[model samples]
Target chain A: MYENLPALKKPRVAVFELASCAGCQLQILNLEDELVDVLQLIEFAYFKEAMSNTSEDYDLALIEGAVTRASDEQKLLEIREKAAIVGTIGSCAYPVGIPGLKNSGDVEAASELVYGAKAALFPSVPVKPVDAVIDVDFHVLGCPIEKDEFLHTLTALLIGKKPPIPPYSVCVECRMKENVCAFDRGETCLGAVTRAGCGALCPTYGSRCYGCRGPADDPNEPSLEALLEKRGKTPEQIAADYALYNGYREGTAGRREAPDG
Target chain B: MFDRVIGKSDLTDSLDNLAERYRVVAPVSEGTRYRFAEIDGARDLDEGYIPTALPPTKYLRPPRENLITFAWDDEIQVEPVFDQSDFILFGVRPCDLHAIRLLDEIFDREKDDGHYQARRLGASIIGVECLEPCDEHCFCHAMGTLEAAAGFDLLLTDAGDGYYVRVGTDKGRQLLTELSGAREAVYEDRRRLRKIHARRDQAFEPRLDVEGSQIPALLADSNDSLLWDVLGEKCLSCGACTNACPTCFCFDVLDDLGLDLKSGTRYRTWDSCQLEEFAMVGTGESFRQPRDMRVKHRFNHKGRYLVERYGMPGCVGCGRCGRDCLVGIDPIGVFNQLKGQPVERR
Candidate 1:
C-alpha cells in the first residue's frame, strides 16, 4: 500500500450574507444528496447558519444577499479581503435582485408598512447588488439560486477553471423545454430579455418569466419594451416588471447609493 | 405500390395487425397540446389529429441517445451502441412524413449515421393525408409538402365509410395480408379521394408571397431583407423553434460517467442553432454572434442552403416552430416579408 501522504487539503469555502433573504444560501443546502459529496471535497470555514466552527482563512467566499445597508457593505469588504476567491451567489449578489426592486419610488411608505415609526431606526437607501459595492470574481445567478450551478462554481474554482456561463436569454430555454408561448396566450413575458440558467422554470409551468435571474449576456430592452407596448403594456408597467429583479440593468433603479445603517 | 379499399372495421384490423408486429405510435392529446406516443390499440389513436409538438423523428434520433460505452478498470475499452426498435409510425401527417424524407437526406449523406439509419430502416411509416388545412397557421400547401408521394410505406386517405389505402412499399404490401376485409379500391373510391384533395387545395390559399419554387431565388436576393432584423429583435434565441422543428437534427455530444467511475457512456443530446453558443468554438469565437444573424441563418438554411445542397426543400411546413416561437416570428409571415410582400395589416 502507498504511504498516506498528509491528506490533500480540501478547499476551504465560506457562505456569507448581506441585506436580503438567505434564499441563495438555502440552495446549497437544497442539494440534499449532492451536498454530502460536496462537503467531502471542501472544508466549511464561515457558514454561521450551518456551522459554529468558523474561520476567516478560506479558499473561496460564496457571498449571498444584496448590499443595501452601510453596515452590510463594511462586512462584505472584510469577507472579500479574507477570502482567496470572492464569488457571488444569486442575483442578490450579482448585479440586481428582488431586493433591488425597492429602488423605486415611495420608500418611506414601503418602509413604514414593515417598520412602522421604527423605520427611522433603520435609515436605508436604494438596494444595490454586491458587485456594485465590491468586485466579484465569479457569479452564480438566479433569485433563489440553482443548486447544480453552485456546485459547478465550486468545482471550477477547485480546478482553477471558469464555470460555463449561460449565454442566451430564457426565451431559448423556454423553446428547449418546448412550452407553449406565453405571448400567444396574450401574456407579456420578459423571457426574451432575461438570462437563462433557471431553465425557463416559470414558463415551464405556463407562467411568464419575471426576470428573476437578471439581464442576459445581451439584452435588447428597447425591442422588448416595444413588444410589451404592442401588447398593450404601459412604459411604467414594463419598467416595474423589470425592476422586480433587473432594476439596475433595466435602468429603473435611479441614482441612489447604498442604505445608511 | 398497390391500392386497397379498407373499410372502417378492416382499417382497424389492419392497424391492429401492424401493431402486433411493430410498436405503433400515434398522436394523443396532452392537455391543450398533442404528442406522438405509444399506442396499444386503435382506441388510443387520435383520429384527424393535428401535427404533434414532437415529431416521429424522435424515434429515429432521440433527444438523448448513448453513442458509445467505455469501461476502464484493468484496461480501457470502448464499444459503439446502435439502439433501434421496429416501430410503425401511424397517422403521420404529410408535413411530418416529408420531414422524415428530409432527414433521410441529411443522415444518408457522405457520413452515414449508423444510429439514425438503424432506426430509419427498422421503422415503417404510415402517412395520413390532410383533407383540410389544420388551422389558419399552417402553410404546408404553400410549402408544397401537403401531400407526399413517397417516404411512407402506406398512405391513408379518409373517405367517410372507409379509407382508401395506397401501399408505397413492400412492407406495406406484406401487412395487407393481415387485414381481414380489405378489397380492391374501385373507381368510385379513388374518385372521392381526388375530390377531397381538390377541395383541400382550394382551402390552402398561399400565405407566403413567393411560390415554393421561387423560395431559393427569393432568399438569395433577400439577404438584405429588413425582416431578419425585425425577427431577430423579437427572437428569444431559446431554441424552441428549432427543437420543435421537424427538420432540425443538430445535436451535441458529451461524456457521462457512472457513479462507480469504472464504466461511462458517450451520449448525443439535441442541440439548437438558435442558442448563442451553438457555433461557439473552444477558442471563444462565435460565428453566429448576434440574434439577428442567427435568425437570418435559420431562414436562409431553410429557404436556400438545404435546397441548394440536397436539391430539396429545407422546411416541411409543419408549423410547430411558429406555433411555439411565442413572438410570432413564424416562417409564413417571415417568408412573405422576405419577398417584400406586405402582410395583411391587422
Candidate 2:
C-alpha cells in the first residue's frame, strides 16, 4: 500500500483548532523523531502553531477541537469545502470532550461564570464535535491524541488507505497487560465501554479509564451499568464518569453501523 | 551411573547450571498472579504456581513477532527473521503442556509456520504434574489433561522429600546427568511415587457434567441456543478470555514502515476473534456483527472445529480464561448449561 507514496505528489495539509486546550495540537510536535521525515512526505499549507506560512491550498485539514461557536462552524465548513479529507484529531474534535460537560447544564450560565462581562463579546454556543458541524473522513481519538495513532492516521492518509481503528474496548489491552482489573481494585472504571488503541493507558498505571477516546464499537451501556452497580457504583456515579469526556455523545454516537466503512 | 530422581535442592542446582548456557524460562510470581519469565535460577521459579495468565505458548509464539524486514534503494531487499535462540520452558503444568502439543499440531499443519517451527525446535519443555486441581475454575480432569503422557522432555512428580524425574527423551536423560544428586529410583521411591499418583487421581475430581468427548456434538447442535445471547450480554468483547486462553493461536499481520519510508518490517501480532473487526472484510461487511455470534464462534472453535480438524481437544482446561475473565465466563459452566446439567461447585 505504501509503494505508491513516492509516485504521488506531496499532499498539502493544514491544522486548525477551536474551543480546546491546544494540548491536542501539541501532540503533533510530540512526533519529534518523525517530524523531519514527515515533512518530506507532506507540505504544511496552514499550521499556525508550527509554521508562520499560511495557504488556502491543502489536500487535508486536520481539525483539533470542538466547535463551540457559530464562527467555528463557518470555519469548519470552509475547511470542508477546500480539503479533500477532513479529519478530527482528539476527543475535543471528535466527541466534544471535557468541554461537553456543560452540555448537561446551562451553557450560557457556565460561559458567563467563566468569562464574566467579556462573555457577551465572545459568545459561546453549545459544544458540538467536528462531525456535528462538517463531514469528517476520520477521527484520531483520545483526550490529547495518542502520538502513535496520529502518525498512523497521517501515514494512512498519505498512502491513500483507510486508517485502521481497533473496534474493541480498553479492557482487552488492560487484561493483555496482565494488570488487575481496575474494578477489581475497587475503583470504578469505564474501560469496558471505552474505545481501545491507547493501550489501556490509565488502568496500566493504576488509574481508572475516563473514556477520553469515546465509546467502543458496540458498547453495551446496560452491561456497563450493571457491572458498575455490582461494584457498588450508583447511577449518578456512572453518569458522572460518562459526563467527564463523553457527555456530548448520544446513547449510540460512537457505535458503528454496517455501512460506516 | 545417572539417577532418575532429582531432589528439591538438586533441581535448583540443575536449573542454576543450565542458566549458564541457555535461557531458562519459568513461572514466577508477579504481584498476585504468576507469569512465565526468564529466570537466572530455580530460586525465581514458583514451584507450586497455578496456571499463568498466559500459557507457555507465549515463548514459542510470542504476542508480537517479526516475520520479515525489507529495505529499498535501487531495488527492494527483503529478509526473513527467525528466532532460533535455544531456551528451556520449565515448570509447565499438564494442561499447558497439552496446550503446547495442540499448538504444535496447529502451527505444523498446512505449510508449516516457519516462525513457530523455528522457536519450537529451539525450545525444550519440562512438565510438572499437578497433584490437586489448581482452582474452582479448573476442569482439567474432565478435559483429560490432568496428566500428560508425552510432549515433554522430563516429567517431575512431587515425591515428598524428592522429585521422581521420568525422562521422556535423550535430552531429558542428558539434563539429568548434569544434576549431582540425581540417582536411579529405588524400590521405596517407586512405591512412594505410585502412592502419590493414586492420591493425585482422587484429588482431581471432574468438574464438568459431561465427558470431554461429548462436548463437540453438544456445541455443534447448539447453533441456535439462547445461552449464547446470555453469554454475549455478559461478555464485554474485551478479548481477555481469548488472550488468556492457552490454545488460541490467531494473529493479524501488518507492515510497519521506518522513518525513512524506504525500510519496513512485516510483523504479526496476536489477534482475537472476539474483537468486532476480526470478522470484518475489505468491503465493510462484518460476518459476525452481533456479539452473540462471536461468542458462539469461540466455543465452537474450541469444542467442535479443532476436534474435527486435528482430532484433539483445543481447550486444555487450564482455566486461565475463566480466572482472568472480568465477567466470570467459564467454559465448564457454559458446557454444563448446554448439557442440561446444573452448575457444579466444589
Candidate 3:
C-alpha cells in the first residue's frame, strides 16, 4: 500500500520508549521472518531496542510505554517533532499501562512501596498514554504485540493500505472458537467486554481476558457488570479486576465509583 | 386480489417441498434461545420464534475462514478459497436483513472481499418481517431496522392464514415462479404487511431517542465525559458485545503447523480488542492500558470513528451487548445517560 506513496520514499522509521518494560520492542524483534523484509523496506534511523545508533528525522515512529517521568516528557516531544507518523505499540502508550493505577492512590506512597527510600530515583507522578503527550497515527494494542499483526501493519504500510484492526470484543472470537463459558468454569472472563485481535489466547489457555488489548468498540460496561454479578461477582470485585492494568486512568477506574443508577 | 389462498396449517408442506429442491435454513428453538439452522424437513422450522442465538451472518461469514492456502516450500503459491454455495436463508429477521446490507457495504465495497462476496453473491436471503419485537433487549426500532428496506431475495410476511411473499430480487422471483402454489402479491397482502410492520413498531418501545447522525457529534463532545471513567471502573472487558454484534468483523490470522513442522495452513479467526494483550507489544508496553480509555475507545469507535470512516454506525442496535453484558452496561443506556436522560438501574 505504501509502494507509490511519497511517504515511502526513503522512509525513515524510528522506535522509542518511555517508562516501560520494552516488551513491545521485543515483540517487533520477535517478528523474525518479517523483520528482514521490513528492514529492507525502510531506513531504521532510530531504535534503541535493536541498535546503538539513532537519528532525529523519521517518517514513522513507533512509541512504547507511558509518559511517567520528566525524561519521558522531553523524549516524547522530541519524537513528536522528528516523526511524521507516531504509532503507539502497547497499552502504556495509549492508557498508561499498569503503572497508571497509581492515579487513584498517592503516587509517593506507591513509589515508596516499589522503590522504598530511593523513590526519588523514580518519578512518582501518575503515568499517561502516549497520545496524552503527542498525537498517535495508529495503535498496535496488546500486552505484547502479536507478531503476525506487527507484520500485517508493516505490510499494510508497505502496500499503502491501512491495516485492519478488530473492532469487536474477545467474546465474539471465543464463540467462534466454540470455547465453553469462562463463567461456567467459576471464573470471570473479560472476553465479552474486551476487544479482539489476540485471537482469544488467554481464554484458550484457561485464563480469563485481562482487557490488555483494550475494550471493544461500543463496549456495554454496565451490562457486562450485571452479567458478572449474575455469575457471582460483586461490583467491587469487578472494579478490582478492571483496576489491575490500565485501570487507574481517569477514563477507566475513575468512573467505577459512579453507578448507572 | 387472488382467490386462491393457503392455510397456516399447510405451511409445513410448502416448506418441505422447498427443502427438497434447495437447502433451507430457518429459525429453530435451541434450548432457551433460537438459532438459524439447516432444516431437513418443515418440522425443523420454528414459526413462533424470537431472534436467533447468532445472526444469520454466520452462514455468510463463517467463524473460521480460509483466506488463502500456501504450501511451505521455496514455491510459496497462494490460492484464495471461496465457499460459494446455492443455499437459501429462510426466516431471517428484517433487522438481520439490514445487518446483511451493512455487511455488504463493508465486504462488497472498494476492493471486495472475495470470500464474503462469493458467499453473498451465491446465497439467497429470504426475510421474515417481524410482527412483534424479539424481546425487551432488542432496539431495532431505534435504529430504523424494524422494517426490511432491501438486500433480500424474498420477503415473507406472516398474514394469519399464510405468508405474504414479496419478491425482491430476480432470484426471489425465480424461486416463487418455481413453486406451484405461489401467486402474485395482492393488495390485501400488501396491506397486511404494513399492518404487521405497524404492530411490530408498536411492540418495540423506543429505547434510544438520539438521532443516528447526531451519534458522531455526541461521541465527539463526550470524549471526555465522566460516564466513560465511571463505566471503565465497572468494565471487565470480557468482549461479549463484539462477539454478539452482527457487524463486528475483526479477525486474526494464524499458521497451524503440522506434526512434521514443514507444512501449515494459515487460518483467520475472530479476534477482539477488549483483552489486555490485544494492543500490547513484546516490550511489555500496553497502549490502551486504562480500562476507562479502552472502554472509551470502544464507544468512540462504534459510535464515532466507524461512522466517520465508513459512513455508518458500527452498532445495529441488536442489544446483544446488553443481553451478554456481565455488568449490564447497555450502550443505549450509556448513550441515554450521555444525552442527559434518566436511566433506571437494572
Candidate 4:
C-alpha cells in the first residue's frame, strides 16, 4: 500500500485523547533521546500536548483513553475515517481500564456523583474500550504505555508493519528480571495472567501487580482466581482485582483457567 | 582423570588470559540471587553462588535474538544475522552444564538452528564442581548431573588452598598449556575430592521420588492420574517454571519492523508452552487449551516425550523451575506427587 507514495515522503502521525490520565501522551513527549531524530523523519501532524501545529489528514492515528460518552464514539469514528491506520495506546483504550470499570454499574448515575449538577445537560453511556465502539488496528497495552514499546510500535507502523504484541502473561518478564514473586512474600499479585510490556515494573520495585495492564491474550483467569482463593482471597475480592482494568472485556474471561499459583 | 592443580593466584591469571581472547561470562551477585552476565574481569565471578536466575543458555540463545533482517521496496532483501561473539561461559553449575547439552541436542538434532549453533560454537564452557549441594532446592545427585562427565572444556574442584582442574577437551588443554603454573595433580588432591563428595551426599535430600530411569514409564500412564487436576488448581499457569527451566526450549518467532517502512528484523524469542497460544493454530483452535492439559504436557515433555524421542530425559534437575516457582509446582515436587508423597516445601 505504501508503494504508491513517493520513496522518501514521511508518514503523517496524529496523537489523540479521550478519557485517560494523559500518561500515554506524556510517554510520547518523553522520547527525549530519539525525538529529534524521529521528528526529522516523520510529520507529527497533530499532537496538541507537545506541539501547537495541527492537521486533519494523517496516515496514522494513535488514540489514548476510553470511550465513556456518546460524543467520544462519534469523534473516534470520524478520526478513524480520516486516518489510514488507527491504534490505541494505554489500557484505557484496549480491553478496558479504570474508566471502563464504570461499565459494571450505573455509569450515568455515578457521573452525577463525580461530575455533579452538570450531568443534567450532558448525556453519557456505559464506559467501555474504544474497540467495542469502533474497529482498532492495534493495541499498545499498559497503564500509561511504556516508552520503548511506544517507539517500537511507531517504528513498525511507519514501515507499514504490524508491531509484535505479547500474548504471554507478565510472569515471563518478571522471571526474566529475576524478581522474587509477591506470592512468596505473602502478597497477592495478578501478574500470572496480566499482559507483559510494562517490564514487570511494579514487581521489580517490590509492589504486587494490580493488573494495571489488562488480561493477557488468552489469559487463564480462572486458574489465577482459584489459586488466589486457595491463598485465602474471597471470590468477591478476586472478581474486584480481575475487574480492576479489564472488567468490561469481551467474553467470559474468568471461565477459562482454574489455577494461578 | 586428566588432572592438574593451579595455585589460587594462577586461576585468576588464567581467567585474565581467557578475557584477552574471548568475552568471559559468569554468575555475578544481584542482591539476593545470581544472574549470568559478562565479566569485565575474573574478580567479578561469584565463587559461592546458587543456580542463576536464568540458565547460561541465554548466552547460547538470548531472550530476543534476531534471526534475519529484511527490507522491502521494489524488491525484497533478506540477510541472515548470526550472533558472532566468541566468548567463554565460566562457572556454570553441573545441572546447568547438563542443560547446555540438552539444548545442543535439541537445536541441532533435525533442521539445525543455525542461530543457536553459531552461539554454541562460539563459546567454550568452564565448569565448577558443586562439592556440596548449592542449597536445599538441588537434586542433581539423583539426576546423575552432580558432576559433568563431559560437555565442558575445563572442570574445577575447590581444594583448601588451590583449584583442582580436570581438562576434558582440546580447548581445556589449550588453556592449561597457556598457563605456566599448572602442575600435575598429586594423590592427595584425589583424596580431598573424595572426602568432599562423601560429606555432600549426606547434606542433599528430597531425592528424585522415582529413579530417573523410571520416569518414562511412570509418566506414560499419567494422563489418567488425578495429579494434573491437583496441579491445575495450584499451578498459576504463569509459565515461570518453563522460562527458568534449562531444558525447556520452546520458542516463538516474530517480525519487527523499523520506522523506515522498508526494513525490519525477524526475531526468535524464548516462548513457554504453558501459555495457551503455544499450540494454537490460525483457526483459533488450540490443542492444549485447558490448564490441566498444559500442566500435564510440560511434565510429560521433560520426563517422557524428550526421553522417547531422544533416549534421554529432558530435565537436568537444575531446580530453577522449583526455586523460582511462586507456587512450588517444581518438577521434583510434582514427581513426588506422582510417588504418592504430595509434599510441598522448599
Largest lDDT belongs to which candidate? 2
Q: What is the lDDT of residue B203 in candidate 2?
A: 90
Model 4 chain B scores worst on lDDT over the 10 consecutive residues at B337-346
TM-score of each: 0.87, 0.93, 0.60, 0.85
Query: Which of the predicted structures, 3 or 4, would earn the higher lDDT when compared with the native?
Result: 4
Candidate 2 segments whose C-alpha is farther than 4 A from its true place:
A1-8, A250-259, B1-3, B341-346
- Models sorted by DockQ, best on top: 2, 4, 1, 3
Give Cα distance to truth, residue A52, candidate 4, Å. Answer: 5.1
In the range B1-346, model 4's lDDT, one tens digit per residue, is 4689888888888887777777899989877788988887788888889998888888888878999999988999999998867888999888887887778778876659999888887888889888777776777877778868777888888887888888888878876775558899889888887887787667677477788888888888566787788777667667788878888787888877665546889998778888887888976688998877888998899888887887655888888888977666777777767877433432
Clashing residue pairs in candidate 1 (N, C-alpha, C atoms within 3 angstroms)? A125-A259, A171-B238, A172-B237, A172-B238, A175-B240
The per-model DockQ list reads: 0.32, 0.55, 0.14, 0.45
Cα error, residue B66 of model 2, in Å, equals 1.1
What is the iRMSD in Å for candidate 2?
1.6
User: Which candidate number maximizes DockQ?
Assistant: 2
* lDDT of every model, 2 decimals: 0.77, 0.82, 0.72, 0.79
Tens digits of per-residue lDDT for model 1 on B24-91? 99887766677788888787787857777777788888878899999888899999988666788888
Model 3 per-residue lDDT tens digits across residues B1-346: 3322344556567778878988888888854557678898788888887766567888888778877776657766667788878888888887788778878888898548898999897788888788777676777777667778787987777778787777788787776644456556767767776787778667777777687668778888887678877777677666666666677777767654332223446777655566555676766577987777877888887778877877755776777667666666888888888888433333
Candidate 1 chain B weakest ten by summed lDDT: B254-263
Off by over 4 Å in 1: A1-9, A106-112, A156-161, A251-261, B9-23, B39-41, B69-81, B174-188, B254-266, B341-346
TM-score of 2: 0.93
Candidate 2 per-residue lDDT over residues B1-346, each given as its tens digit: 2327877888788889988778999999877788889999878988768998778888888888999999999998999999998889999999988888888888876549999999988888888899998889998888888879777888899887778888877777776767668889888788888899899999988889889999999998788788888888888888888888889999999887765667888999889998888998987789998888999999999988998998887888888888877677899889989888433332
